[model samples]
Target: MTGGPKASRRVICAALAGAAALSATLFPGAAALAGPADKLRDSLSRGRSAEISAPPIARFVAQDGRVFVLDRTQPAPMLKFEDSPEVWVLSPSPAPRGDVIYKNDLGEPMLRATRLGGVTLFSRQRPAGEPVSLAGGGVPLRLGGLSPQALSERMLQASVRSGRAARRQVVFEAEATPASAALIADAAMVVSLAFVRLAGRDRDALGQVDSVRFSEGRRPSASLADGVLTIVVSPGHGLAGRPSSDRVAKAIRTAD
Candidate 1:
């Protein structure tokens, strides 16, 4: 007589799958982007969480057929595109109609989810948003472990790229260790993203960044002082140990 949350989730998934199929037919070539969607759907049919209150970690298929995964199990929720190695930390905010909107560090909308389990993704590829349907629960996103040597190399490469873009020395001073390797490596990218965000706001802002310093601390944070950007990472905080790239950028902006 009554199906409960799991049954409701299945029905929603079915409806979305139907929509996706119809879209493919109406808009020729839409099927090209359905590979990931098909895979996700198959996984969902296997099993996943059915409650909207605590949405499951899952892959979602956009109306345009683009695929991405959203993992909420992390200390800070993370998003990863199917074609990218980068994992984005997103901040959740309330939206209309009992939906939730996830935004990046720059306060830009990345994804919006309805209470019923539908998602809308916003990106440069699709500024407005593309309707996204539940695919199925997905694996958690984990930062790859790097040896001390590899960590040093990654920091070097990241600093070089940041420096080249800034037209000045973007030296990085990091304390390396096996436990902190992944966080440190990701810190380099966070600083780089911060620089990019700064440059986006003001083309010459990158000129103000001289160096970046990383250290372990009680909490994650970023600060800019006298042209130096310092990032504090708390190893105990796990994935949330380092200040987000958006926070790094904000620190620079506020300092300027």
Candidate 2:
């Protein structure tokens, strides 16, 4: 699996050395170098997409347009240890397009990968056509330079394809306790219908949504952020396993 959109757009640190060069630099002691068989095993252990036993894609590797080459052999260390250090493989996600957020705050475009203390924060929080809170009383959603129609179209397209666009978060918030899980689900469904209408795409969009989550904030609130939603529900009000409100269900059934 390749890295997500954030991984691809972060202009690879120009100061960083090539993959092999970086690997050599990190493990100059040579005592930690893995043998050819060990390298083969590591490479084969990768996901099915990566060509097994094939050559690395240049020093700057990119699997599925996202930077996958890190000078780690899974990053080989300079000193061999009794057991191989476990690798940190984040969830494999579809990459995103577009470069920086197109900001002018700095004299020039900000490098998506900025030097933040010792770590790099690739400003990739907003994927193309990201979904926002459809809650009633919350502030309006700003689509950067895109219009609601355009965003909807992009989301529909993403849904049909296998990229980040298809993975949108639909949120449902409640202003009080005893919130109905069914209501939250209905809200999510309503949002799905909105996407279908906006994009004029197939109604299969409901299938794109996988995990429907729930949470409670300080007050009765519903908002979308960090690709997440916060909502309020009773302690025993278990949801996600059943249908939503009758009104919403009727609409969905009627539509079908």
Candidate 3:
């Protein structure tokens, strides 16, 4: 975190070069002797090794005093901001100088992390990203189930708020389970936020929306079409199954 950009780049290059040499020494003629199938296997093995070595969970605090948690225990990386119920799954891509950039579903870079623990986060308030320091390891996120009655109550409240804001009846449908209840609550909040935004923009902004549906899936996503909004939450995401309200609201606005 203390190094300038140039220094950081140099360090990243040196570390990557060292890792390459080590891999070459361990695998010997892996590249030249590998057939197509062999090469694919080797590539996957290396990817697994990289995942194993990366921190499973990490905590960081930005210079602006905002805290963020990065959870890499799943197939995808999940990030959560301090004091927010939203969890975002980000796709990771390799950056120059061996850094990794994590992007949101819309392909916007949200975080850039150096191999040596330096992190820079991007946000609307700071489009260029602010460098943050590694604070420590963080608590692994989990989805704790809620009681059926509690789940229904929360869903009802969210629907009421959304309906009132949209000036129309807003129906919410979901299958209730302890794990899915958490997702339901999260989705409800997003629906409410989107409805509020629409109402603020236009008096009958959400009139086009009739009902919202929440369901569990392999991927978390939101889509609005034909007077129906569907929110898909992936239970495999653990607590990260919840999509950010801001992003969902934006998606709804764009779709409508």
lDDT of 3 by residue, 83-174 (tens): 66567778898876567788887788998877545778898779999988778898776556778888788789889989999888989888
lDDT for residue 27 in candidate 2, whole number 0-100: 85
Estimated TM-score per prediction? 0.68, 0.18, 0.67
Instruction: Answer with 1 or 3, whichever has the higher TM-score.
Output: 1
lDDT of 2 at 132: 18
Where in model 2 is the C-alpha error above 4 Å? 1-179, 197-212, 216-220, 231-256
Report the number of the highest-lDDT candidate. 1
lDDT per residue for candidate 1 within 1-256, as digits (tens), equals: 3669889999999999999889878986767677788866865665433323335588877788877888887656888878754678788887765577888866789988775566678988799888887777777877778888888888898898788767688999897677788988988887776666566566477777788888888888888889888888877666667777667767877785
Kindly report which residue stretches of model 3 are placed more than 4 angstroms away from their true locations once superposed.
Answer: 1-55, 161-169, 177-179, 193-207, 236-243
With candidate 2 superimposed using the best TM-score fit, by how many Å does residue 162's alpha carbon deviate from the native?
Answer: 14
lDDT of 3: 0.76
Off by over 4 Å in 1: 1-55, 105-108, 124-128, 135-138, 196-201
Alpha-carbon lDDT, every model: 0.77, 0.30, 0.76
Best candidate, TM-score: 1
> Regarding lDDT, does 1 or 2 come out ahead?
1
lDDT of 2 by residue, 1-256 (tens): 3676656556464335476577678887663555766765664465223211212211222222222222212211111111222111112111222122212111122112111111111223322222111111111111123344443454344234322323444333333223443333333443343344433343453333333244443322233334333333332322221222222223332342
